[model samples]
Target chain A: MTLNNFIRIFITIIFANYINSKINFFITDYYLNFTLGFLVFSYWVFTLEEHLYALPSFCIGLSIDLLSGSPFGLNALLFSISSYIIHSYRYSFKIFSFLQVTIFFAFLSMFYLGFIHIFMNTANFSYLLIFLSFFLNGIAWIFIYILMNRFKKIFYK
Target chain B: MARIAPGNTPKLGYFVLIILASLFLYLDIQYKTFTSTKNFFNAGLIATNLAINNIVFSPISNLYKLTNNKLALINSNELLVEELELSKSENFLILNKDKLFNDNSELYKFINNISNDYPHEIATISSFDTNLYKCCDNHRLHLFNNSSPFKKGGTVINSTGIIGQISDSNNKVSEVILISDINHSIPIKSNAFFCNASGSGRPKVLECKYDPSLWKESFEIGRIFYSSGLGGIFPEGIMIGSIISIENVEDGDILLNIKSIANPLTQKNVIVLYPNDIK
Candidate 1:
């Protein structure tokens, strides 16, 4: 990758980290998964960039693990698997419109929450929260895509 | 030449891997052998947290500098001075013979006595897994506070109420199990009855199982519950939560729904209480 691409990636990672901390309000108690997971997962899938996805996912998941004091590989493993699954399907996914990506991400997010629930054996989880998170993820992904698209054109062009 | 189709081997391999990983996770949880693996992952987690903190600190610090004004700063200083003087006068009242009825010293002594009873060291909570069902139990509490005298299995608290017990302790950090964890149970009581209030691991919900025959009518909604001191985990009289509702089950047990007063998300600073009598 060129220097410009490197900087763009770095900035994305930084922005992703900021969001990870700020979005704790939504995820801390009700959702075990980070709200940032939705954003990060979307970013990787939309970019269709496989190589760049894993490290960031690991780093971000690890950061959350430390912040919340959870078992070490738990998040790293979850995030990596989530990103990889999304990455595998990136080629087939039609991302021409925001709504399409939103619907796609909503389904994937269920896997995320479901994985956590099964892992923790927690009961009475609100499906509404999962649905809300999917909606929030859609909004977040679209906004970030627009910003990142702009950055890519300005700097990479 | 004829057309060729892609083999299904890759897809099948991926599925097999997932199934294997799932089984490994289940076994790890059942056998409790993932501690070392968790610690290794935790090292990476700590590094990531530090990096994020460093990145965010600059912008937050810049914002603080941008908004700070001399007048506001001076007012804060003056308020601190006044608060210091007021405490000094309160201290003087405790020392004087004429004001012996108040006995502020006795209050201080009581507090001191309790402090001595449960000597603690500070630990910063690092992370918690919110997932409810992993067999090896993916839930863990990482903390940065390491100098705590209490080891793993020691109890933690804040000024308002009990936080959780210690699950893991290291040189510079410790992990605490929040009262919301299914693994934790504290013996609790009210003014009229006593029972064990178990954490449901669901936020804001606790279960108090009391014998239906004993003081069943006395347990009312909105009544406060306190630590009964029977579990040896918590000190007596610390507020747990209020009784939200009560239900009598066919099993002849009364279940009290307790809504925890402590909000762990907001309460960061906690005291890790270590009993003096730990053998």
Candidate 2:
């Protein structure tokens, strides 16, 4: 990626992490966790042609792991695997309807939540949390998508 | 230009990176290989946070306070009120020294030096994830000690009671593993029965499991728990918490859920007392 794109993605990732942390403070009372940062990362990788490289994805994951209390490389592993998955299905995603893609991302987020919980919070794992987070994350993604589109239009114009 | 699909992208590159990440995750979970790296990062983060608070927030708040002379006076007055509150907490420790250490005279000898003026340094809460504190098992908080360095294993207390002990220290920032943390355990007693109460991973709750057949005394709710001083970490007879509930487990052992008296989130300023210092 060019330096400009690299800087932009880096800032977006950090900002997303910050927002996730702040939002989690309120939503955890309902046993709901939104993997906003991971969703943002996935969204960017799917939309941007310049975001296909696994190295940048890995580096971003490491940055997230550092910022979060999660063990090192947890995000790194997930992000790299996610990049591979997204790249493999890039063509299929083009033909898929918006609702189908949203559901797919929601399932991806549920997997992310379950995987992180196994490693970090095995004692308090609730199936309810996974069930609830899927729908919340799907809605969150829709909002993020619309907001990003509006921001891009304003920027490009 | 269309984005490269996985089938079109170099497959070997992604495989190598995934394998590398797996190795990192394995090493980190197995051996805690990245602890020092994380700690270093945390220390830097704490320092940066402190700098930002001082450079930006403090000045803005100070200027806002300075807008009105009455507000400035009230601010100074609030500072005095805080000092009074701190001393009142210290006084509680001093007055209760006998009650707290009546059973263990050895511990009493150490607490005798708790002076009237200021016996301990006040540490302020630096970064506490109230979200994790409420929802997660790993309950810990970062405390910024601007005065003397904090002693690891020092008892951290607020006006209410014993909160936790210092688990780790990085420069002036220390980590306190709260009694609610799954890894933390404290020896607590009520009247005749004594047991090690482990963190329930629920906020302000500690669990003490005992074989029902072993102890003759029937445990009831609202019974106050006191520090047994078996671990020598906390002062003896200091009120830890009260029994809130009881549960019979599968193994025929009864679990007593004690609601801790001290809530870490309630008090931003805490006093760290090193019992070993006087010893």
Candidate 3:
């Protein structure tokens, strides 16, 4: 990658980390999972150089794993799997509606939230959180996508 | 355009990367392999975030502070309320320090007397895991006081009465083991009715069994019990609790339920007295 592209990727990773920490105040006691990174990383996969997707997805996941104190490779594995699936179906996304895409990501995020709770916080885990996130994730990203579309062009391009 | 999708080599690369990630996940789950890495990254992230937040948001934050007049008043009001509570506790402590005893050593005598009184350290509880306290047999309290050092066996007392004793202590933080712990036992006396009360693993209750035939007189309910100082851990004549109930256990022994006066859950601050001669 060129230095300019590297800088863009670095900036996006930092922004993703910031989002992962902040703006989850809506869910009081639940582990606030923002799937913005997942959403944007998949978008980058579909639009950017496809071969670069998995590596940067892994980087983003590793960053999240370190920060969120999850199992070190859990997010990396999930992101890799998500990116691989996205890469395999890159052409299909062109025809899929925004709602369809949002529905797919909602499950992905719910799995992440549920798995973290099962492995790290079994004593405090509530099944209600996972059930709630399934619906809330779709609504959250739809809003975020509308809000951050302008910035995506600058970073993803 | 061709650079957007790598044909064959990168597909194999992604597979290998995911496999490696799986291996790392196994290692991390089985044995925490990356905790140091996580800790190091966390330290760096916190420092970086703090610096970035201060530099980037300080201007807007200052502007918000300048515009909001209510926040300053609220902050001052909160401080004044907290100070008022602290002063009230101090006044209560001063007035009641010697009032517990029928002796004339009130605030006037305590003010001028140092050699006759046992010095105690006042500490605020910084941390207490309530879940662990209730569920587990081991009950412990973490206390913080920077000025004074606490030692093992120091008697911990709350505003109401005796609560626990310091099991471990350092310069900054100390751990107190509550009397309700199964391991703790206190030599208690109630108007000559003496027995070694054992903790029942229940909060505020201690268990002691006595032979009914030996005494021939039933221990009355609501009778106050005091520490007899036989254990050298607690001072003598301090009120521990009252005889709440009496039960008949197996082997013809009568069990006495001693209800403690101090509840650790209610009290925020406690005093730890180091009485070397109390034994």
Candidate 4:
């Protein structure tokens, strides 16, 4: 038996968030953050059926919000908005080159980081961290994209 | 036949979800409508973590220690640490005995009746996210106090000095708002000036903003600051920190950055000084 679409997306995003939080434990001291969960959500939106994604994405983000210390619904709002945007642009992404897509993801991740910092931690916000992580996330998103595509092959098969 | 791309998907549901989420976020942040929910969730999470540690990890570690013959050494070390903590707390009580009782005759009598035994509870750190502590303004710690419950606004101190105060408490654990959290502030004074030093959101740092025109006193680096007892939460004359740097802001205000003397991360156990005990 195979997992349905909702379960697949839910498990994948949860795993991404868990790994992202664990990775942050070691790197946040150095002023770095990786938005692996957001990346995975965007990828799933691009690949899967899109019309029903907004609700599932919202629900999944609500689950994550419950476990996190951030204000309730912050992640849900962001995930819903991101799902909408990525879904709207999925057709365009099909024709874009790999480098352009990577660049787009890097900038999107930066926006996510910046927005969260503004609402959740305005006092400790650092442009230096956001600036540095842009490059770091750019590199990280490439690895995540490739690795996720490999898993996608197994799931689709 | 081919499936339609997600780009062509309907947009109405997404719009509705976004609006719903935004409403929830606003309500939660503005009115703290979900604070009780968050607290309940936190209490449950801490309980689960403690249960896992006690039921699974503790016995596994004990078995490993029994097989390795290191249990005795570990137990001795733990005993020594406990003794050291107790001694440190005793020293604090002795040092502040006079000041803590000067105003409260009833409390003083109660302390005298107790003899040398001080009234304070030792709480162990339950959960702390160093990542948020280092990177954000919310420097909170979950502390487990199995004894009597910790009262909110009670002062929490380690071996060094004041680390924070109890902000919230439930059945399972108490939440500590560290001095370095942006939302926390302590009324502090030096030789010349008095101001409320707010948390800088940086580890072990607090910032005091004052107008240069109103406060003519000059501040220099390394100048010591002490609690002013204005808020009545913390004891007066206790060492808070020292001025580390000064900067002039856009509105002709002077911002003095203080490096706090107490480091919460240095110890696993903290002593909670209830106001009723001291006042």
Candidate 5:
């Protein structure tokens, strides 16, 4: 990676950690842990054409697992699988509609939250949050995509 | 132009990484091996937070404290004034301690009989049915103590004189049958004339029917009466009350209505003297 790309990743990790901490502290009290940090890292890695996804994805998931107080490699395992699937389907997404992409993002978010809910909070986990977060993450993807595009334009301009 | 994506994902590589990650997770959860790692990371995060709090939040808070010095001083002054008033009241209690007890010469002897170290307590009436006290024969009262337990058969007195005895006691509350309860009677002394005065079912009223021919002096109104302590229930020579009326009828019985000095309505807080055997 170039110096510029390294700086971007460093800042994005710090910013994602800050947002994840805030969401867990304030917003995720009774809801699902939105996995904002892992999602941000996944979005950045998947959009880039470098084909070097697994290493960066593992690092991001491990950082989130440490910050989130989950089992050490729980997020790493799940995030790695999701990133691989998205990378393989990236060419297919070129012809996909916006609703189809949103549905795909919703499905991925639901599976992620539901899987963790089964292991981490089995006693009181609500499947309702998994379904609700499916919609929320679908909407959030649009914002994340626009913001990344804006950053790319500013950085490359 | 957008670059072409990778035609396929590396399934074998992904499988290998998943297996490795799953093994790490299994070791973490099953053996808690990562607790120390998590604790170390937590300690680092906490140290970072404390540093930021010191560098960012502390100066702002110090500035606030500096600006609020006048408010703190004002609060301190108010607290000091309240404390001074409480101390003044306590000082008044210390000065007038003797006057709170009655003017009986046998007071010290009576207290010594109860206990050499004086182990009695002061209690107030928590509940007294005034309507029933005036009209009913029971005249029971509930007493509460912040000091010690008021035992059953303990003597109850006020600043003026002996009023009654406690009929029941527990950790929380005690019941007292006042001197005016119809079932109650106190042995009294009046110039070698002794009789048991029974309650008249009225506040501060007790009636004693005696043979007028026994004592040389005729029954006189306003004559002083005192507890003789003959029954071992009450302390002797406590000024109980003065005679209010003497009526002689055809039955040859002298009916006397002696008024009590300690009115339960007037003097609310009474002293309880617990006997040594019941202590």
Candidate 6:
């Protein structure tokens, strides 16, 4: 990646951190729209290469752990596993279209959130939350992917 | 973008890390290592939040000052005039009485009477965990600290009503076991009945287990409950909550559903009670 691309990614990561701090997941409330936003961010991290993305995911998880006052390293483990899954599968899948990527990410995001529900021993894992999270993440990913594509078109050319 | 193949060895390492972190978290929960870590984390978080709050509020505050300058000045002048009138009245009361010295003695006596009611000093809640479970446990520790003048099991409160009893205390912060914890049992009473109200781990709710024979009439919704002061943890007549509902079962047991009058979630300030004789 060029220096400018690297800087753009760094800025995006900072923006995500700020957003995470401002938004409450409402893990307390049974269902909320904020969880969907979290899933979208998680999916974006998942699509990236492991070596390049693992460090950012780790930082994101650490920031969350600090901000949420959860037991240290809880998010670290969850995000690490999610990114690892995406990295492992990234090569086999063809990058046919934005829709395909969105569907793939939605599946992974659901699995990520499902794993958290089981780990936390919540009363019920709202399928609505899971499905809505995927849909929202898909919507967010379109904007991000479009921006990345545009950047690639103008600068990479 | 170039992608690298993941080796089996690194994946195994990640799995091991997950297992190890999970074990640490579980052990921390069971053994309470998280308590100290939570305190340290809270201190940092409080500092950061304060800085953020200042930054965010500064602009709004400045704007308000600019727009409301005349209003604020008028209000301050009014307050000063009221203070002057009150002080002049107090001075007249002092000078007009032949036995003004007795009034000083009476004032001293009043202060002495209230001084013993609260021996331990009040502490501010500087920071709290965003996660409810973590917040609950941290609050429990803050009330329970040994150093607090509150008896091993004495009640804590704010200006409004009872919060929880002193479960533990330390030099800096005391652990407060909230009324919502499963382990808490407070002896409470109403005008017509007395019972032990137990916590069910739900916020703002308590279950009062009363003897069926004690009640001449069935407990109804909206019946107010008060601290019986039988357990010596709380002072008598403090408002607990009104009875939200009641159920009597076939086994002759009675359950009174109570909601606390004071919402602990929104309480930014609290007072710790120390028995009169502690000094």
Please say which candidate is ahead in lDDT: 1 or 6: 1
Question: What i-RMS does every model get?
Answer: 7.5, 3.8, 9.5, 4.1, 24.1, 5.7
Model 6: per-residue Cα lDDT at residue A49: 43
TM-scores, all candidates, are 0.68, 0.88, 0.50, 0.86, 0.47, 0.64
Q: Please write out the lDDT profile of model 4 over residues B31-71, one tens digit for every residue.
A: 98987888789889889988999999999998999899999
Report per-prediction Cα RMSD to one decimal: 7.3, 3.9, 10.9, 4.8, 26.6, 9.1
Candidates 2 and 4, the one with greater TM-score: 2
What is candidate 5's TM-score for chain B alone?
Answer: 0.59
| Worst-scoring 10-residue span by lDDT in model 5 chain A | A24-33
The sequence of per-residue lDDT tens digits that candidate 5 reaches over residues B1-279 is 234477767677778888888887999979978866764665466557667889999777757866987656755786786565434333322333354234544555554454552346667666565534542355667676456557778887765566788876555566788898877999988777898988876668888888767756676789888787777777667677889988886668788999987677755566777556666
Docking class of 4: medium
Top candidate (DockQ): 4
Which segments of candidate 2 are over 4 A away from where they belong? A154-157, B1-6, B64-71, B81-85, B92-119, B277-279
Clashes of each: 23, 1, 1, 0, 0, 15
Relative to the real complex, the DockQ score for model 4 comes to: 0.52
Error of 5 at A104 (Å): 1.0
Please give the lDDT score at residue A54 for candidate 1.
57
Q: Candidate 5: global Cα-lDDT? A: 0.69
Give the runs in model 5 whose Cα sits over 4 Å from its true position: A24-33, B1-8, B56-279
Candidate 1 residue-wise lDDT, A1-157, digit = tens:
4556655555565566556555553464554344554455456445743244555556555555444434444555566666666656554554336576666666666666566545554555556656666666566666767876786677653
Q: lDDT per residue, candidate 1, B161-228, as tens digits?
A: 56677776554456677776677788887765777777775665788776656654577799877777
Query: Tens digit of lDDT per residue, candidate 2, span B1-279?
Result: 234555576678788888888988999989989877886788799889889999999888888877765676877898998888777566666655554543666435645644421146678888887767766777888888665557778788887788888887777578888988888999998889999999987788999999978998897789888888786667667888889999999788898999997888776788877665432
